[model samples]
Target: MNRTISALKEWLNPDWARHRSVPPFEAGLRPNRRLDEGTALLPEAEFEPDDVVIRDNGEVVFSSGDGIFTLADGVVTRVATLGGQVGTLLVAEDRMIAAVDGVGLVTIDADGAATDLCTDAELAACVTDLTLLPDGIVLATIGSRAVPDWSAALVADDRSGRIVRVDGSRAEVVAEGLGWPGGIENSGAGEVLVSLGFDHRVERRAVTALAKAGTAVGTNLPVYPGRIATCTDGWWVAAPYARNRFTELLLDEPELLREMTATIRQDQWFVPRLRCPDPYTDTLQLGQLRVHGVIKPWAPARSYGLAFRIDQRGRIAEGVHSRADSDRHGVTGVASRDGRIVVAARGFRNLIEPQKDKER
Candidate 1:
């Protein structure tokens, strides 16, 4: 059987010796129109949000290149301008902390006064997500050190991603050689759950033993997980993009991947984006597929949007999706509070509140 399987692999992917393949989306992560059933909770805009958090005062805010902004009474308002693009936001003790591009992490208080927390030279960029541990330590996932951004890092198969711990003015890398650690969250049990994008799994590690790669809580995920926020029962995880079999095949052929990267426009690369911007040119004609809303990729939606929940023990709870054919792609952030769920469909440039939202 082993020989037959190997022979089949050779015959199917003859050009590549590596056995790279896409994980199945079954069980709790199955595809559905749950996200499409959702309503646009916030007014449409070009904010290009990365993460959103419900403040202690019951204010809804999100992180974007334009900085932190609040949404209330169906109106969006900027609360602070951190002087650079923001990656993630965390609310702690009446103040908000954000990962600002080129500036490290900055704390914004009630008055929107921005103060630098950790300006470590290494973490000046590529900070993916942030979470506060029970012991007050702040953990951050550095997507990669080899590339300036995620697209380049994934294309180059970069493995410099790390988990950094921040204590007041000190910041140090405790875990290294990660596969695009895109999301971080505290486990209420004193452990931390990290979503490994390239590895396609969620790992659990002791805050003290982060030097270890930890154990898998969820493995062989179908989507590249992103920012995760604690929910009433477990945690809500965002998937900015979904896996593509063709892309996986392309990845196994390094020479071909290299040549394509060199010759093709970055925008047209077989990579995921916030949305299928130019339907005509996008590997998939999502625009044309929407007969009234349906279909996927000429290739899959490099524009897939998804979010799921994992129980405290890392068991899959439930999930939702925008589908490759849908414009609601790149769901990078999710927050649930006061019976209301807010999802940042960054690709769609909108926030979604599923039909199940009780508050609204």
Candidate 2:
């Protein structure tokens, strides 16, 4: 497939190629509706964020699909195209780092030298989220997929998914069977907090026994919680693509509340895709065809962006990539350190706009 067409296909039918084997009826589900507020129209100008990074000295670094975007105090200073999907940026010790999709991690040291820190295979494992530990240990998510395309669905990917620890060439799986883990953060006590995307829950795993010992601390979040951050006190989980509304289940006992919450099903007839038979197979097969409550890209108020934060207990101190500044589709990658938000937004508006121009 041509690169442009393939990219557009990934954008248009995000779940098609990977979920082909599963029956459509089983695969598709109607989403539970929230109180339908009138559709909200955010200005297009506000949503045009490129691959960007921030430096410690108040320098804004960004790339617009082609070159580097130089900024001083949040104003664009220069622009240069550095080809690739720039995911997350890390500013450490006077240096800047950009995690590019497919091309491992790149670090620009103090003297402005850029170097690769990890390998492509290590990155292709889909390191959706990352966190830097005090002792040079970097925790990242290696998400699994039922079929490769299913991963595009932004749901479950448990089989091949893992929480990996990277300390310069020493890569190890600390946690396994994590469902499309979208968020990673370091707990103040040396533990790693991860968001189980498909499962809609938050988890904490000790750094040492990450492969084996870990437990789910919070459960039953409303929708897919993408980015997570931690501060001096508690935590913040962002449900970027959550149902438009939320409700608190006021139950007496925590255990009873947990049990009751687990029983709620957003789509009863939608068959959940679990795993694949072989590692190499990427196509999905549909068993049945059913369409109900399917989300359309043209629908208003259907934005999907990264949302999460870390703060004091019982109160959210700071938040991230607000719903006001998000796109309707595409995978959004998020990471934060010391209160700075690094975001990577990927989508295919280029293909659509050109066609619209032709018709006009």
Candidate 3:
């Protein structure tokens, strides 16, 4: 009965009822209708993939909540288990580096031996993503120190995120007071681009300018951006989950959010999730109702998949999407190899190749 009343109140609220508008696609761009048509590289893996990287030897390695795994020729092999949540994966020459929840940055060799590259003092918080530079330097993004969970960090909205530079186990803060930093990648122009998750944009900063302010590169993205990877022509940015209109409305409702955080489970909270286990029977947000046995793909997407290609100038070149009605949601990581773009769709627990040539 309480759930029904809450749903009724959400339905009646004017701010919550209003749908979040997405800007129309630019010229030469269209929505992706067949995002699930690609092949699943790891069909048997049960863990949620967070990031993927292609090694120099043509091997594909991905990090999941369980650990790091490698896929080659339809075979999946376990590399190493971190005993904690793994956030991102990076392959540097012969070493595989990963960002772990409680373990900080770790390196896994070819023999699956795990070694600590950076400890809690270097990270001082949860590490989300890392990038390998040409000169053997590492750039990482720190999400928050108060909470180890990403969802909890978002709910707290403390703005304690930052970017750090790690060299030979030594780490230094390059930028501070960010809004849930997610992805990190070199911009090829003496600067690194980072995804500000809660800010809904990407920013670029130089490594030497530790205390200098950064400039926004990609602004007003529709979804929360995750990992950003360099491609042949430019960079690929992943939007893991769609923005929730109801949640946006409640951002200023501090008392309500505090109560909900105290009472509701992390997975059950009305936030953007990677997967929807029981969308039909679960508590509905304002615009996510099933009407007459029909669920619209564009109506209040809970876990939508989206990726964008941006040119060197940071303009969005192309995009692909999997709507709320599709199973290929939560695209967190993207990589390009030999002219093929591969994405880690965490919601579906598979690797997908977004059809870039398909037109509207």
Among the numbered candidates, top TM-score falls to 1
Better of 1 and 3 by lDDT: 1
Candidate 3 root-mean-square deviation in Å: 6.1
| TM-score for each candidate, following the candidate numbering | 0.89, 0.56, 0.87
Q: Model 3 over residues 164-265: C-alpha lDDT tens digits?
A: 889978888877887878888988668888888888888787767745667978766667888889888888888887777677766656689999899987
Error of 3 at 272 (Å): 0.6
Candidates sorted by TM-score, descending order?
A: 1, 3, 2
Q: Write the per-residue lDDT of candidate 2 for residues 1-360, one digit (tens) a residue.
A: 454665688789986432211111011112211101112112233333333444556455654442445545334543323336554455556665565666666676655556777764656535566778888777777656333333333322235567777777556666776667767777867787777766666777777777763577555543465556554346545444442221111211335444534674423212222211221222112212112533232222223333344344333233332221223223243333354444444331110100011111
Prediction 2 TM-score vs. true: 0.56
After superposition, the stretches of candidate 3 with alpha carbons farther than 4 Å from their true spots are 1-30, 122-125, 281-283
Which should have the higher lDDT, number 1 or number 2? 1
In candidate 1, position 357 carries an lDDT of 27
Query: How many pairs of residues in model 3 come into backbone collision?
Result: 0
The per-residue C-alpha lDDT of model 3 at residue 187 equals 82
